[model samples]
Target: MAPQRVVPLSLRKPTHAVCVVGVEMLVDVHSDVPRGARSFEVAGSSGLEVIVFYDPERAREPTGRFRWPLHAGADVVVSVDRASKDVNDLKVKVSYFGEPESQALGHGVLYLTGVDISLDVDRDRTGQVKRSRGDKKTWHWGPEGYGAILLVNCDRDSLMSRDRDFANSQLGSLADLQDMSPMVLSCHGPDELFDSHKLVLKVPSSDSKRVGVFCARGGNALSDYKQVLGPHNLSYKVERQSGEQEIRFYVEGLTYPDADFSGLVTLSISLVDAGSLPEVSLFTDSVVFRVAPWIMTPNTQPPMDLYVCSVVDINGSNGKFLDDMSYLAMKANCKLIICPRIENRNDRWIQDEMEFGYIEAPHKSFPVVFDSPRNRGLKEFPFKKILGPDFGYVTREILLSGASSLDSFGNLDVSPPVTVGSKEYPLGRILFGSSFPNSGGRRMAKVVRNFLYAQRVQAPVELYSDWLSVGHVDEFLSFVPTSDKKGFRLLLASPRACLKLFQEKREAGYGEAAQFEGLDRVAKRSINEMLADTSLQSDSLYVQKCIDWNREVLKRELGLTEGDIIDVPQLFSLKGPYADAFFPDMVNMVVLGKYLGIPKPYGPIIDGRCCLEEEVRSLLEPLGLHCIFIDDYLFYHELLGEIHCGTNVRRKPFPFKWWHMVP
Candidate 1:
């Protein structure tokens, strides 16, 4: 094994005041000094001084450039301090076997490698803290601060066991050492701390140079280099010839160590003229820095020639249709091009619609996310030319070049039941027609009823209907919904037949069998009356007159005076049916309670108005019910089904308190 080299990372001749250029002060020696080796000490108030040592045997007056092997089983120590002239500030002594000094000066570069840092627990162990590297460009939460002891590697092997053994063998000399674990240090200043976390150790680079040991904390006799590095199975030997000059270096079996270097750190040694000469000194200075990792920002503007056509009913708007297609593509693990273009009348519009892809920008949105598709470039599709006359006249082909997601299909319908395989109808229903009464209870009931009728032959499945007309619901429930209900086993005839029956009945003026006007009429009835005989509640009314139901509940609950009429239809306009349901519950609890003479909480009594009343809470508690108090009825599924509250509120509020039921 070649000698392991050690460089002074920082150095300056002893000056008026003690200053360290490379690493911090104290240096550790691995073994006892050999006979005839000279040690150097500085004592003075001079501005700057240098330490020079050399062997006349190797080359007289050691100067300029020279390399000496760091032999195994050798240890060298260098000490420096502000020595006063009165304390016999300087002294020099030379013995036989130790040669004369040389005078040479030329700068040489060193590269440090094969370094190791390890951790170990102490007896009656006290805990040590080390920070782990964090994510880039973001602040991170920190743990409580703690001190870490230094542990260096002696055995330079990859396997931790060898290093442990080497470290243990050196533990005997470290009795005063309180901890044996390696100190993992971290840069904590607000600046980019990651940069300073690394130590760039430089040693005279050579194939023979095997490894080096280092510590930020000063090394003492109590510090066991072997115990700290025993498990590594590596070693370093340094000998000061001719009073600490011509420092000999050597290495044994060793391995590489891990480093999280994010910053630039400098480590170098200063060359000098003579060995065994007076005024030999040690210098140290360290540079600290923070580093920032590279980051890439995205182009925020939507691409030109890309326009989004939104299809609302999963049936017409191109925009809506595209959304569904994107969803399907995602499910199939298919990648697609983002920002596809769509023709609007005569002008081409590009849409930045980003909802389709993964969104990383906190407030930014994108239509598609993932790897770009296999092809690129804009394409024009002339549906008539490629897909035949079945395709419309405006045919333009979308040219895809390179990897991209954009794909062109001559006006192919991509809506429901469009499975990848199914022989009967290779392309399932692609055309989406317009729907009336786009929202609300009327829309909901019609959608549900239609879906139910379509799948009448199958088990009655809940139609996952949002808002749609009665006719569409009939078609959906009877056929489509039933087929997808997975094997519940109840089926009904086609939707067309059911729709005919319903229209015929309506024409005959028979009306709903419940014989009710609409939701308005149903809401008009007192809560007490509805609760007493829920059979009187009507589904048709709940569907047609939601405002009537809403206003009636409101009037009853608030005790509206004459001429206090509210615009029923306009007041109830909102997007979600679920939210609409909440308001009705508010009416139910407050009005019913007021009519039944329920008392309100007395947190407020200003100006004759009890402002902070809990009347709604008091009334709904006993029935395991709570009013949303917003303009909707959001009863739980169990209550909605069992109590049939919307259609049948015949039962009195049940006898339970709000606290009695566990949420």
Candidate 2:
């Protein structure tokens, strides 16, 4: 077949290329398509260069061309050369891309404008509280934050006095954190309407983007009724960035009904979005907000282990309050557990069994327990039946074994006693009572004392009190003198009352020697700081001291000195009444451990926490267990002997000796 013949350009041929004279026009191309369709060849000489369109799907490849200086009736014609590849076998059209140029991007061109508004209340923003900077050319967000009205006079370079003060009053007080200054858009002052100016409002986002909108008075800012906006409205177009987000606040007729007001609206350009964004606030003004995808935080992989601790089954009117005691025991390791009360009067032993069962579980122990009835149904008790082979039984067995000491102190040795039925099992004296600040200090001393005994402590248990609540502060203060036994009642109340008492005593002639003479030297020092600085009086000195001590003890305990400031807000993070219970000894842990630094042969307990059976295998991998089999004075050392021990054989650590060898 013969190739198509090319049409030669001549005066008889239609001259111009595709010209968009009216709404649209068509141009035809012959056979071949070209690789680079750079310029078009038109028959007629036209000075103007017009844009050309190809198939919309393939925007970069234009099949044909067009001519400019188009009139309503003009039709464009293109001369396709056979040598050109791009123009072969195609047709194209030309037309106006968008609306007419008379309208531009928006309804009309916007000019420089400003507005004035008023506030009805007193305003405060940190240091700038008393002073009004209305006529001040520009305002800055102070170190703490800012508060103000919604008006500005850029032309005069000053704030309108009355309107400025009114705006300030509406601002109230600036907070120390996020800025939530509610700018006064417009206000009615008693009788007259003052809608005579334009306002410059800076809409700010937390992400530091700024949007300045000109709000005119008697318009949306001050108008009471809905009004149609003129074509001369602001024409700012924010092309959405790849991940940019937006929240719009609508002012009734001024803004679309649906708008996002998640950002702060401040007169000052910088701090407009410091607190809540104007986008967020617009919702409060009868509009809904839609947040774009750009504003969201990137997603992250979820955490694996949360490490929570919970105490099981605290049974009592208020004694169960220690349900979260495990929270304290584990420190920040996990959350606390809440358990159901086991109240079978006859099956009291079952309750004991249940308590021991939980103690043996892998999780830490909490002081919460279920209240039980007197001895009636022992065998049929539900608590005992909870000893499933899977968990409960093993836990109970572990507890029983741990409590089974050769010289372990039992219930018989207790003082002040455990009340079983009508029998008072005197276990130990109430050394101190840490009052509960919540409810009446109901049986707090008795329950804690019993718990201590159950945990294997024989006598003299110290008690902590919750002194803050509605009542019972004075009652606890009275027990300060006589209960100063070992681990006695450590008064863990708010530092407020403690400082007040110390101050009163100090000013009245007697210094530290006046009250609570038995308190340790550190406690005395804490009291001194509290008395000296009135500002620190309300701050919980005891809690602070505990935190300081904990930091020190943890440093010593973990052998960490360089990065020692790990645990903070110690009391707040710990769970339980005795969270502050161990505070007295926190400072002493370092002092005690310093003398025993890394015992010879690394002595028994490796690391800090006592080794459990599960962790023993891994730990033995590095340093084999130091076991000594001394038979009739002939001693032999066995490395990793625990691994080979028989099922019935018990593993024990070897005594420190100079002859020990390194792994």
Candidate 3:
């Protein structure tokens, strides 16, 4: 190892300071000595070791005393093995030799004690309750990726706190401390060492606003944690009581990692020389922590609970829709939660209101719901009803500018865990829609988008979705779990596939069968009539081209081949330049483990079974997925929505620990 520091030992008087065990300090020797001095002699007590090296081939450690001829380039190295329990217990002396003993220089006394200081964190993804001395700086991903993990104090554990715990600097309640990570400072030395020297725990000015620290002053009283180090205060003079060996502090992240910030905050303790005019640090021990990112669970994770809204609007009633959902929930054995009309205010689109995510650390983990800025009927539902105890609430609003339809979370979805080439998205990548090439169109709020991008773990991929009426990603694409080669498959709505299916049925002598045969007020047309209509034909082809563009992007960005994607037979009608589902949209379905609740596409009854229903059943059944078609036509399909738009699911988090991955 290299020397801890370098000091110029003055020959005029004794120098007093503190020393650390096993640390080497190089002393500048043979400088400013008398011109005719023939030799130099150096010696130290039992606690200290002295080394004299002037020759490259041979370096000597003098056990008792060292005497050397005057040389131009000789250097001295000194170290200590034991601490000095009393003042002036250890001393080193240097003398100059001239023609007579009367011309010799006086020796200086160095009265110092050696102290061992260590600052550590959990390099493995486990809790450091047992005090593991692992690397606290470098953070990477994989089975060998090592670093300490931190969770943002975003949740309110105390009902007395009106806001999230991180928002306030003062300690509001005792329960709020459960959201933070623990850090330990181990200092070992003699009791008399601190009588002249001092230690400082500090944070750089640049990182002061990003983290908060609470004192662990060993007691049950809430006032014991009154001292907090954060944006207002950057350093703390360590209050080391007599015989105190170690001290602990609780660290909490104040804000999320952003583009300007890397989410890595470091805390350091410096041993300072109190006797100097402008204090100088003798040694510094630092530790690094990476704040946890908000992660979204994909549809593949096992569903824990499902949510929906009940409303009797001017156009439709969701009573039947609720019943069908209840049946599917029973079949999947998942809990069903329905928001009454009084709370929903006739707005039935629950999926567009909010998105579900969570943040985790080595010691604690909890769910966090991201409320959208779209102030609909369920605008206050997430904060007022869902946020309680360990559950968290987060929101980003376009305060200066109003929100657009693209701001709805219906445009947000995440892919399953994927291995793209050498890169692995163990938590999957986030997918959302925007008008990228066409800047004149409506887009998601920049504030919301920036919040998503700051979560460095799941890199987000943007897609163009402004061509539709609702401009949501759920209208055309979805993902479902399977026991096949990829473990899941991407389902895309393809107009060309629907046309091909109709052509095959027409060629098979079923041209007389019509679509939407029993529905009231809905246009019912046979295969021959639909195929011959040139206006519908051109719109179908145009819609197919738009979907094809997204298909290419998804395949390239998600690293999927043609075999990994399954096309659902769907047709669309053009309203001006925007498109919408002509019948019931089957692609927008609710996924729960291996069970799926799909929209009932009312096609002609052939062989006593609906052709479109059998089509979807044939595509997904072979992969061990159970499809249950629910009647969401009257309430959702006609309203430009489907099952997924009317329903939402909160699923279990990924089994893999996020700290193991390097982003």
Candidate 4:
């Protein structure tokens, strides 16, 4: 083939050579130059340099190089003018070239911005995460283990743009590329990871090179990353970092093991690039994880295991009462621990100097005794420290005395503690009556609540009428354990039931009015006197209100139905004054495990019935609880005391330990 003649540059169109720099390189082209010109020079904008190279051996190679000004994602246009004679200027177009696409090779640099790690212990039950600087390498967890959260923030520009498929694939491939990835996080120790055969955690992802194993030096790997996140159900999303694209990593779960896991553990975290040729890697300081010792408060449960009461030998008043209580304690198969009288003086001093009410044995103090787990003997059981308000009395024996507080003539501020519970939670609540300033007021209630909470005891306060002669909760209500499905039922005083019985008896022409006709004037006069007293009327109103309030409280708070309540019939009466008057009381009974000690209802005969003992038994027998009617009127009830006032019971502890359950 014949060679084509070379055209003269000055006679034909002007040729151009373009070089683009400072931006990405996309294309390069060089055309053959005309043979007539020895050398050519091109000129353009400032801050640019052009170099021309001439080599005789390589005739086709471009002889010139130029540095041009370029912006990211913007096109660059070059105008080449012919310095030779008689030639026109030619315009050459250059493509745009910005930063690279690879995350490690992009214009933005990857940096470890902020790291947040939190440790939570279950013993405190606060669910608070303690922030750590991660300077320390060792951490401690409670016996029930703990929960944690780790946050890793990366520079925004280092992250790829949003592409669901690409992101998912990268996350899916993480396991395979973990060895080459930049960061590794893990926990190491016995049972370090929950429910996994291998203690190490292998976070699965599409791009293992992007996210690798995260660990602390002494820590073990997290078990089942997916399972650990099962509770939180975490999700990922793309975000901006410093005005640039970013990807966030959020991992939360229960990381520590149970009490069985103890000793030192290392949590190591490291970062390194796994790109074609990586040059950067980072490692975080290790943290410590320690398992603390298990501790818990011992609370009291019910079903009386031991009976505690003081024996008073003053004026021989409580001798028969003591005998009856002892016999009842023996019948119930409970250990009777009799506390001696607070006054150890002679009988004359006790009878003459001390008030008759002060001789009441159980009035001295409210003893809450707890036995240690290692102790099995009842005699060695020690009393818990006084938790409630302190009464200004000489001896600690009057700590919870109900004498001054209950008497209407004295004060109604100090409330006597009454422990009660339901079938769902036996002996779980310590019930207290509302107090006035004269009694132990709201301050006492606050102190009691705070004390119970501090001691890990759960209790609730209930409202009761202070207008009654004896403003004690035990005067109107009691709790008895039953063999029924409900486990326990509330015993309440019902004047309506007594009135109904009296009316029915009268309709049959054998009521109290008809049987005891001679005592009618006395009863009628007493009723008139009670109605005349404004304080008594106020007391009646308060008593009705208290009954209504308690009914609702029992139903709502204790989860009790009408069937779970047993109403005992009794009528109100006035003897002398409001303080000295005595009303027919029945709910002031004692609970001895499966036995119910009730007062023998001694009053005028009605429908051939002189006493309601048989009726009371009939009403309670169906509930699967036995009843024992004792004559407490002579020594106890008549003297302004009830069965509970003369006795107390020390209960057994619940079987399950508190530490075993989740906080």
lDDT of 2 by residue, 325-413 (tens): 23232332333332323433322222122222111101111111121222233323323432222211111112222221101110111
lDDT string for model 1 (4-23, tens) is 23333212221111222122
TM-score attained by model 4: 0.43
lDDT of 3 by residue, 280-380 (tens): 89988878888888899999888888999999976667788889888888888899999998888888888999999888887888998989999888998
TM-score of every candidate relative to the true structure: 0.19, 0.17, 0.93, 0.43
Better of 2 and 4 by TM-score: 4
Give the candidate order by descending TM-score: 3, 4, 1, 2
lDDT of 4 at 600: 63
The model with the greater TM-score, 1 or 3, is 3
Write down the worst ten-residue block by lDDT for model 3: 56-65
Candidate number with the higher lDDT (3 or 4)? 3
Q: After superposing candidate 2, which stretches have Cα over 4 Å from the reference? A: 1-131, 134-181, 185-265, 268-663
Native-referenced Cα lDDT, model 3: 0.82
> Regarding TM-score, does 1 or 4 come out ahead?
4
Give the poorly placed runs of model 3, Cα more than 4 Å off: 1-4, 30-35, 47-72, 80-84, 98-105, 129-135, 315-317, 436-439
Q: What lDDT score goes with residue 540 in model 2?
A: 51
Candidate 4 lDDT: 0.35
lDDT of 4 at 577: 25
Candidate 4 residue 558 C-alpha distance from true site, Å: 1.4
* Top model number, TM-score: 3
